[model samples]
Target: MNERVLTPRNRGFLFLDSHPAGCRQLVADMWEACPAPAVPPAGDRPVALVIGSSAGYGLAATLAGLKRAGVRGIGVSFEKGPTARRTATAGWYRTAATADIARAAGRDLVLLNGDAFSDAMKDQVADLVERRFGGRLDHLVYSVAAPRRTDPDTGAVHASVLKPIGRTNRTKTLVFDEEGAPEVREVETAPAEGDDVEQTVAVMGGTDWERWIDHLAGRGLLADGFSTAALSYIGSSLTAAIYRQGTIGAAKAHLEATARVLDERLGRTVGGRAVTSVNGAAVTQSSTAIPGIALYTGLLRGVLGDGLVPPVHQLAALWDQLTGAAPLDLDADGRIRLDGFELADDVQAAVAERWENARTATVADLADLDWFRDEVRRLHGFSVPGIDYTAPVATDVPWPGHTL
Candidate 1:
């Protein structure tokens, strides 16, 4: 692919030949183009830091923290390279938009591109907190979704898998990429090993969550009455075997477990609390890649469209909780169940019935599902409004504060 072809479809230009500088200019231009929105500054206007903050729930969380809570200065840690065949990562384009949004809102935003799991990155965050905002962060949102992680204690790298246990559960999925509409294709299965489960837990679990909190506390970057939360999800039983019961489920369980650890640790401080928001299923780059989920999402989309709650609304609710405007209710496992709408017994039962019957769902039946598909594609800087796709985009765009 041509390097210039990598620029986002919506705004600005990306020159591959000078990727670093181009990315930076793109970010700067986005900042310059932001629209100023009037928002009331509340309670000292805390500094918010978002990890995995480039796209999807992470980006939504960042926006909520700023627009809702009147957070002024922001820091984001995202993983995307300057030049790659895949073009700029969704997070890269999102940061540009986010910076633009913040600037338009008359807020200051700083973005850092790096591994959020690193000590160096943590230190960089701490220094920023100390220097810019007086070592006080009112809200911290952890929204990283990774397929692998290096065990800090063992120094071993673990990769997560997506497979079911016990038997081969074949399922049909709709091929939206085809112009001819939904085509059914049977998906093969793979049995997950014990190591797969364990490694998935290691990679997706709460160890890193704890580390971020610990490092922040140790560095004295945590402000009084600080609130922190992470995102989690649980789909229907149709996906339980592959999702909730498989490697990813193991990791989610670990993530829920980490919330308690963090709460306990942060509670020792003044008015500090850790929370886990169990989010509803939405189309995201990570979620779409999960097997058997696309069909379910499509069907559920149409079913829930009349009364379904969007992820942005859910995130806004989370922000409400963070700012003490709403009560923090915990489930039996001490985690927030924001997916209550989807997890409703009737909802899952309906989807499960469709799954069991193996009915061929058409695009009209899955129109709601397209929202997420479009959003995910937009995250990759494709299919967005206002950009001419025919024009070549430069790949070598300089990202502000992006360190290789």
Candidate 2:
């Protein structure tokens, strides 16, 4: 085994290396932090498939289903494994650790590492459902976040961008100065040009979700009352111009529309359901790359304090909804709103005030920059508490489940 005390190699918001031991600790921490279900699940050994299930809300949802809902989960993600010289992706380590945890708890949690948008990947997952999980899919959670996708039919590559739709946006964003201190600065983002919206929707929208459902249904893999949820976000007006009104929002709108279509079709055919669950913003790899989200989430964490709903809690409630233990609190648009606490009137008011007056001098006071920084580091398997960063750890860790 190759051993080294790995440190993070980063450029701005992007991280290039991950610590395997730290990722394991993060997964363990999440398992402990996640709350148990309010009541027992309705189904026995319910089978679930979580796409993008290595990190962020996907990972949380996977753990929630296993620990809180007693699910047999199959997680699919595309992540790079470690080589002799380089460490594996954070998702890779997280998935490996999660598989081990599930084994220790006597739960069934198989993982697949590959391109989820590809037709071959879907076929492989369907086969697993049929052979390994009794040919019944109880839940399908889509939490995929990718910069680009290659269409299986057309073989055309589509790349998604984070930009406003019609107008250029100027927003106060969080940046790190030369001294590595947090600073709030004004950043200008140009509007989406040409087929930017189309490309973004192709990559981030529900077309792939529809394809997954159609494929599974065709294979007769959907169980009775099978439900699917595609994760989305509709933030407050503080980030409306760059988030809810931006190119990514266009994709989310399309996703929600597709959910309606799938919900109707599933209900009509097999008593199933579908929804776009608008989750609360938290520190995730994808969210940090957005223009205003870093600043918005920082302020949100500061204002909400203990009230902020983390992804694991939101997904655990989703498990309740899936298993008849709780009702799905759907909005007028037939979408699940998990971000209610973040969008509370008082919370928004406080955050708005902070947004207006926040500067480098008061950023720490106005926002939870420390938490934000720690969470970002934690995402890449750094800055996790109780982790021995000085000790050499094996970088070549193998996933403890099936890989594609």
Candidate 3:
């Protein structure tokens, strides 16, 4: 059973069981709030394959592709279904919502659920593109987040760690109870040592990403002029200790390197281009589990204030790049930076200034804690504005593949 903690305001970890009504409302709100860039009359309608497309950035991107670009898509994920033991994962309900909405609008969608890192899953995707999508995909989006991966080459399990590479780092944040009383606390990251870096790389690195591409290319699944992108993150020096300089950061660095390799390889092999999109740091179920990201994002939300960009917005910017609504605006490293505003000199300066003086007492006044808390709960399909928390929400939500 999954661990769950709920708050009086209906904000907290979503335990076992599906909340279908809440998920449906969440999708509706996301769609309404995040309309895509204008799609020209004759512009390219992407036939896309999205790994991890059931939730977070991937889900948003998939929705935009369907609603704005009117594209058919295959969404692959490894989300759990609800059972007697517990509630269904948010991805399952989100997928159901997406497919239901897409089918109503006559948009074709197929949901593939499994270990995306597996070799068989890669083959499944290639065959899927060949059979259902005419052997070619205009776009392949990788937005997967997982802690562990089993090496198909050797059947070895590798788990990624979220610790500093050289030293332990102390991170402070607040926790709320049902009474809304806030308690200040510190979560520390132990130093990553021995095989931690290598294990983290094996679990989170770009080898699987490359393998996915290699398989697709071998099967002639990548369309001519197809574009592929995997998301990455690079915040400020403040997060460098825990993220940009830690185990995950090492993995990200390797991921970015893999993008360059794929850029050249895809161009040469399939007449396609591959690039990494550096996204802004924000709330997600995964990010909340990390040691320092919550505090960092809380401060970030406070500094950025009114215009804190969610992952969906970054995904929208990515969609814009694909549709010619915006240029790639490649950085010196040839990767896209959707965090341009977040990394701006003024924003960073303001945040750094406040961070120095931010204490437990000052965090609420300094950081946008309410937004951070809401976002954290929202990740678990809680604290949604319109959903009735006390109402009966069915646990069973079937895959939306019937819409295909």
Candidate 4:
């Protein structure tokens, strides 16, 4: 019986360990708090596949399908299991907990742990769909976020960078000072050099997503009227130079272009559709790692207060659009805009005003640093409510579901 109390270890933007019990509790809370869609999707119980379904927007999309749309789901993610020396990643515990909750609610949500970008993994999922899910997919959601990706065709490994495209980006960002306290400081990210843009697009772009659709569609997997969405973000001008106008932005643009291409192809073949859902900012692991995003989101919390939409709530709205319960609020480029509130004129004006006056000393007044810190801690199963952090818990908790 090996057990110990796991406290969070913060190493800059990373957490060293995750608490199994705390992560379970966090997932349970999210499942309970998620609001059901106004109207469930029509027809029989739908089937969905959510790639990168263990965390962030992917998790939200999974829950939206299972709980709101009454869909039996297959979730694909890459998560490291626990060992004697270290606990599993937060995502491992989250998936396990989600499986438990789904079973209790009489819903089916299968989790598959592996590199979803690989051809082998795609084949595995397609076979599973044939055996267990009626051989058709009603919806497919792509929300993978990773540092690097291996090209399944060329065996080339491409790594993504957070650098600006043409010029060095200097901006005020959140950092831990010498005292290990949150502080506002200016940081400079140098311009991308050489093949940085191409490499970034290779890693985070739409190529893999396109491959997934092609593989599934070729195998006659996508159902009639099927819908697919890939999550994206378009941040404000505050961090645009390092985010929306950076190498990652180029990758996102490629993603949007892929969505358009897929929409046309799917519509022609199966009467299906594909969209890039531009989501709002929230406290996600990927968001916190961006250079200026922590500062910008903190200011969002300070100014917007309760007006800011959480990820799950945004997903509920998305479910409505997907199910025809509401209209698809597409922007000019034919992408869904779930970020309207965050981009509203008044909200941006207030946040911009606060940004200009932000200094280390004045940051407390201008930003919700406590909320920012707590959200980061909460991501790794720390600082959760009603969790006995002092008590020991098992480290090697396996998901009580089939894994490949």
Residue-pair clashes per candidate, as listed?
A: 21, 0, 5, 0
**Per-residue accuracy of model 1 over 1-404 as CA lDDT, tens digit each:** 34454433322112222222233333333333332234455556778887877656776677766676667655556656554555555456567656767778777677888778778888888887788778787788889888777766677888978877666666666555324344546787777866887887777888888898888888877888888998988878777877888778888888988898888878887568998989988767687778777777876776677466665567777877787777887888888788888888888777766665554444445445456455445545554555565666655445655321
Model 4 ranges off by over 4 Å = 39-43, 178-180
* Reference-based lDDT, residue 97, model 2: 90
List pairs with backbone clashes in candidate 2.
Answer: none
**Candidate scoring better on lDDT of 3 and 4:** 4
lDDT of each: 0.69, 0.90, 0.77, 0.88
Q: Candidate 2: what lDDT?
A: 0.90
Task: State the lDDT of candidate 4 residue by residue for 1-404, as single tens digits.
Answer: 66998887868869889988888888888888788656554677888899999999998888777777777869999999998788899999989988987888777778999999899999999988888888899888899898999999999999999999999999999987545587888999999999999999998989999999999988999999989999999989999999989999999999999999999998999898899999999998888888989999999999988888888888878877776678888989999999998999999999999999999889999988888888888889988899999999988888666643
Worst 10 residues of 2 by lDDT: 35-44
Q: Which stretches of candidate 3 lie above 4 Å from their native place? A: 1-18, 40-44, 177-180, 402-404
Q: Which stretches of candidate 1 lie over 4 Å from their true place?
A: 1-41, 82-86, 166-168, 176-180, 357-373, 392-395, 402-404
* Best-matching candidate per lDDT: 2
Kindly give the stretch of ten consecutive residues in candidate 3 with the minimal lDDT sum.
1-10
Query: TM-score of every model?
Result: 0.84, 0.97, 0.92, 0.97
Cα lDDT over the full model 1: 0.69
Q: Candidate 2 on 297-387: residue-level lDDT in tens?
A: 9999999877888788888888788766788788999998888888888989999999999998999998988888888989999999999
